[model samples]
Target: MAEIQTTTLIDDLTGKPLDAEKAHRIHFSVEGKTYRLDVDEKGADEFHAALDRFIEVSTKVAAGGASKRAAAAPRRASAGSGEQTKMREWAKANGYEVAERGRIPAAIQEAYAAAN
Candidate 1:
């Protein structure tokens, strides 16, 4: 005799069964609390798009939870013409993700200072 087993993956937010290939695991943290969600491709895209604004301005965290800004702590931005532009350019060139406009990450400022 032979037996077959099956399992269904459901989208947490939509409560619908997800196709195995379309299933996604999204992980994120908020206020120091970590979370995981199971969703389909569409849900994953929507979730990311909704958070894109905040995510762009936010600092990237290392796997172990330590971030450059948190460690640097309370640094000040230097004043000058096109400082933001220069920082953004440098950041992009150096593979850092920065927003189009907003509070610049202190780490980028520090790196720019050190570089030039």
Candidate 2:
């Protein structure tokens, strides 16, 4: 029979040594709550698998968020364009204290857009 060899486990990110019990456990936090998941000797592999899935899903979500903002950029640009200057002038003429430069109020923008 061959002798079984035992080795210490180390956390890749924290650079901390883990004993057998801890090495067989995964720790995580969600919404201010902390939780631990214990597994058999396959725990290390399972933890890595979960981490991979989390990264993949979050990456997709982040990409979708960026695209949503990109899609809104054109509307934001139009809001500050010459149409807004025309609206500000209209609002000031109609007794609304329009700012010299900055965001024009939504009511003024709506009325001007409707007028045009």
Top candidate when judged by TM-score against the true structure = 1
Q: What digit string (tens of lDDT, one per residue) describes model 1 on residues 10-112?
A: 9998999999888999998777677999998889999999999998998886776743355557656465648788888989999999998887788887888
Candidate 1: worst 10 consecutive residues by lDDT?
66-75
Taken over the whole model, the C-alpha lDDT of each candidate is: 0.85, 0.67
Tell me the lDDT of candidate 1: 0.85
Q: Point out where model 2 deviates above 4 Å.
A: 1-23, 27-34, 38-75, 79-82
Among these predictions, the greatest lDDT belongs to: 1
TM-score of each: 0.51, 0.38
Measured with C-alpha atoms, the lDDT of residue 76 in candidate 1 is: 61
Model 1: what TM-score?
Answer: 0.51
lDDT by residue (tens digit), candidate 2, 37-74: 55554556767786887767663433234335334444
